[model samples]
Target: MKLDILAIGAHPDDVELSCAGTLIKETTKGKRVGVVDLTQGELGTRGNAETRTEEARQAAEIMGLAMRQNLKFRDGFFQNDEAHQLEIIKLIRKYQPEIVFCNAIHDRHIDHSKGSQLVGDACFLSGLRKIETIDDSKSQEVWRPKHVYHYIQWYDITPDVVVDISGYINQKVEAVKAYKTQFFDPTNKEPKTPISSQNFLDSVTYRARDLGRIIGVDHAEGFTVERYAAVDSIFDLI
Candidate 1:
């Protein structure tokens, strides 16, 4: 099915932590939104790959997503090579989403930056008519999203645009909390990690609040653009 927006993350919960608010807001408008996880977060200290997969499923349900898929790329070691690009390109052709939200340009995790560049490259290469790809049994057509944006996570990168998700903040928080093993869980006696902390968990919601405060909204999610975001009329921006 054609998607209005497709959000991709290096790890299962990356999209929830960074851009769930924006995604929840979109789905409420009856937009066809989907997610593609490049990795299952197999290397995380707290949860196993199986657990991460289940969490992703629950999170997708909370966000009202149209579909979710995992490419099963190597968790901390995936590369920005032709093989990986072709995989992402196939999905781009299959769904033909108008916009894509990808990992930040720079982040604490090496995979985040790698994923950001990889996805950006895939989006560009997907537009080239000569780059052949196949889906199911039939050859797929060349397709490229019109806009690609990078969602801010871990590191506080300045945003080119901030989406006001005031009314959707509660649902956003719920979607993020679905990843019980990945985030702040007092009962999860497995081990402590950067994200398992209560403060880190709070950051997801607080970060949205902080961004929202700057723009006079109750909640917001920020994204950096590949190029200038355009509006036919200046009033449309408001």
Candidate 2:
């Protein structure tokens, strides 16, 4: 199925923490959205890979995503190489999304930056007819998304665009909390990680509020673009 947007991340909950509000907003406007996680997050401090996978599924349901898939790449060691690019390329062609949202260009986690570049590169390569891919015993056609935007993660990067997600912030929180094995939960007896702190959970809300304050909105999500973004009219900018 053709998707309006495909949000990809290095780990399962990355998209939920960073851009699920934007996805929720878009989908509410009748846009079809999907999510692709590059890794299962086996190396995360709090949860096992199997638990993370279940969490991802729960989050997908909460977000009402059209599709959710994991590439099963090594948690901390995946590279932005040909093999990795090819895997992403196949998904791009299969989904044929118009816009792709990926992990931040740089982040605290090494895999986030690598996955960002890997997916970005694959988006470009997917358009080349020479770089062939196959699906379901049939040769797939080349398909490139019109744009790619990287959502801000651990480090706040200046965004070329900010999406107003004030009304959907609660949905984003719910989606992130679906990963019960990862986030701040006092009830759970698991060892605490960086994300398991109450402050980290608060940051998710505060970060969006901060971004929104900059743009005169109640809450917002930030994104950096690789190339110039165009609009039909200046009034489109808010």
Candidate 3:
């Protein structure tokens, strides 16, 4: 199904932790939003691929996503090449979302930057008619998103755009907590990891609030763009 916005991530929880508030805000306004995870996060220390998939489903339900799919790319070894780009291109053509959200341009995780470039390239190539792609053995039409935004992750980067998510931060928190195995859990006997700490879990909320305060909002999500965002009038921005 066509989507108004598509959020792509290197792993399952990336989108939720960074931009689920924006997704929730959009969905509440009757917009169709979807998610594409590049990997199952099988390589994570705390959860296996199977558990991560289930958690992703739960998060999707909480976020009210219209569709959620994984590309099954290798967790840490996926390359940014034609093969990878084609995979992303197929989904872009299928969804035809006007706006696309992807991983940060650069991050601590190698996969995040790789997935960022892969999705960005796919967005541009998907618009080329000569780049033939097929779905279900039938020829697919070329499609490209109008805008591609890279959401902040694990780093403090200046944002080109920030969306006010004042009333929807709780939804973001709930959606993130849906991945119970990946976040802080006193009952989890698994070995501790970078993201399994109480501080890490709390950072999610505090980060949003910090960004919000910069823009006179209660909560917000920040993103970087490939190009300057145009506005019709100065008053169009809040």
lDDT of 1 by residue, 1-238 (tens): 9999999999999999899989988999999999999999999998899999999999999999999999999999999999999999999999999999999999999999999999999999999999999889899999989999999998999999999999998898898889998888878889799888989888878888999999998989999999998899989986
Candidate 3 lDDT trough over 10 residues, lowest sum: 135-144
In terms of lDDT, the poorest run of 10 residues in model 1 is 182-191
- As a whole number from 0 to 100, the lDDT of residue 26 in candidate 1 is 91
* lDDT at 199, model 3: 97
- Across 1-238, the per-residue lDDT of candidate 2 in tens digits comes to 9999999999999999999999999888889999999889998888799999999999998899989999999989999999999999999999999999999999998898998899999999999999988999899999999999999999979999999998999999999999998988899898888899999999999999999999998999999999989999999876
- The deviation in Å at residue 95 for candidate 1 is 0.1
TM-score of each model, paired residue for residue: 0.98, 0.98, 0.99
Clashing residue pairs in candidate 2 are none
- Residue 43 in candidate 2 has what lDDT? 88
Candidates 1 and 2: which is better by lDDT?
Answer: 1
lDDT of 3 at 38: 96
lDDT of 3 by residue, 45-100 (tens): 99899999999999999999999999999999999999999999999998899999
- What candidate 3 gets wrong by more than 4 Å, as runs, is none
lDDT score, candidate 2, position 75: 89
